[model samples]
Target: MRRMRTWCERFLRKRSSRAWFLTESNRIACVKRMGLEAAGAMSRSPSAKRHTSSVSLKILVDMDGVLCDFEAYLLEQFRSKFPDEPFIPVSERNTFYAHEQYGSIKVELKRNITDIMSSPGFFASLRPISNAVTCMHWMRDIPDVSVWICTSPINKYRNCVSEKYQWVEKHLGFEWTKRVIMCKDKTLIKGDYLIDDRPMIHGEEQFKPNFGKHVVFTQPYNCNVTTEWRLSLWPERKDKLLDFIMFLREGLAFRD
Candidate 1:
C-alpha cells in the first residue's frame, strides 16, 4: 500500500507539470497572435465581442449587389450618356451585356467614378438598391450576429477603399469598425452565408465545405451564376431580403 501511494503521487506530479507547461505555451501563442510585440497593440477583443463584430457573422454581405446597387448606378450613367440607346432601368437590364453595345458606357462610368468618388455628391448619386439599406439596418439589430461587407475593388480603383467607407457612412448612417473587406479571397474569412453577385467567387458545388450557402444577387452582367437562389432586387422579390435577415436573426437567436 505504501509503494502504490508513492507511485500515484509521482504520476500526478508529472501530469500536473505537463498540464501547466501546455497552458503557458498556449498563453504565449495567443499573445503573439494578438500582436503583443507591436507597439500600442491592445489585447485581442474577447471571443464574444469578435463574434458580434462586423467581421464575424452568421450572414456576410457582398458590397456591390447585396448592399450597394452598383449595377443600378452604372445603368443610370449609361442612360444619361446614351439617352437614345434604349437603355433600360437597372432592374430591367438583362445579362446579355456585350462590349460592342456597352463598351463606351463602361468607359464613361470608369472615368466618372474616378472623378466623383472624392466629391461631396458621390453618395447622392450612389443610389443603393431599394431595400438593401433597410435589410442591413434590420440585420444590425440581431443579437451576436455579424454583417461584414466583402468586396473586390479593382486594383486600378484604389480610391474605392476610402470611397467605400464614405459610401457606408453616408448610406448606413454609421461607421463600421472592421466590417469592410476588399479582397478576392473572401472564403478565407469565416462566414455562415455569403450574399454576393459572383457565383465563381465561392467555389464548386459538390466540393463545398461546411462554410454556408452562397446567395447570388442577379445583375445584367452576372446572370450565368451556377447557384439557384438569385435575386434581381429584394424589393422586386417581395421582401426576400427581409426574409433572409429574419431567418438569420432567428437562427442566431436560438443558438447555444
Candidate 2:
C-alpha cells in the first residue's frame, strides 16, 4: 500500500506540472482575448474567468493504437497459435473484432475477440509504430505541454496493467513510466486533448466532445471517425503533431 501511495504522489506531481504549463498557455490566450485594458489591468469580467476555467490543457496520448502497432502484434500471435489456419493479411484487419475477420476463413482457428491479451508478454511485446518514439520526445520537449499516456487496461488480464508499464519503460524509455496512466475509463479523465483511435459513441449516437479537443489517432478500426486531426502513418504523423502543437502555441498569441 505504501508503494501505491508513493506512485500516486509522483503521478500527481508530474501531471500537475504539465497542467500548470497548459493553464499558462490558456492564460496567454485569455490575455489576448481581453486586449481591453482598463487601468493597466484587463477588466475583471465573468467571461474571462469562465474561459480560463474551461480549458485544462493536458495532452492525453493513447498506447495501443497511437504509439504501438497492437493489431499487427495480435495477428502475429494468431498465426503462431494456429499455424494450420490461413494467415489473415494485415490489410484485412479493418475492425476491432479479430475473430470476425480471421475466424474460420479456411481452417478455423476460432480465437475469441479478446484472446492472448492476458497471455504473458503480450502488452510488453507490441512493436512501436514508426516515428512514435521521435514524436513522443518532441511532444515532451514542447513548452509547458504535459504529455501523458492514458491507456485502457484489459480487466481480465491483471498482467496487462504491469506489462504496459514495463513496455513503456522498455521502448519509450524510463521517463515515460512516470507519465503512463493505466485506465479503462478515459471519459473520467480531464484533459485539453486526447489522441486516441477509440470511437466516441454513446449507444447509437455520437459521444459529445466534453473531452476538450478530440484528436482522433487513425487506425483501421477508427478510420470511420471524422475529424480534422485524423493522423495517418508515421513521419507524416510526427510532422503533423509538431505542426499542430506549434499552431496552437502561436495561434493563441493572436486569437481573439
Task: Indicate which candidate wins on TM-score.
Answer: 2
TM-score between candidate 1 and the true structure: 0.55
RMSD of 2: 13.0
Residue 126, model 2: Cα distance from true site in angstroms: 0.8
Tell me the TM-score of each prediction against the true structure. 0.55, 0.67
Error of 1 at 36 (Å): 43
Residue 190's lDDT in candidate 1: 65
Q: Write the per-residue lDDT of candidate 1 for residues 159-192, one digit (tens) a residue.
A: 6666777787778876562677776566665677
Residue 179's lDDT in candidate 2: 91
Candidate 2 overall Cα lDDT vs. reference? Answer: 0.62
- Residue-level error in angstroms, candidate 1, position 241: 5.9
Local error of candidate 1 at 40, Å?
Answer: 48
lDDT of 2 by residue, 115-185 (tens): 67677889899999988888888778655678899888876767888899998998889988999877656
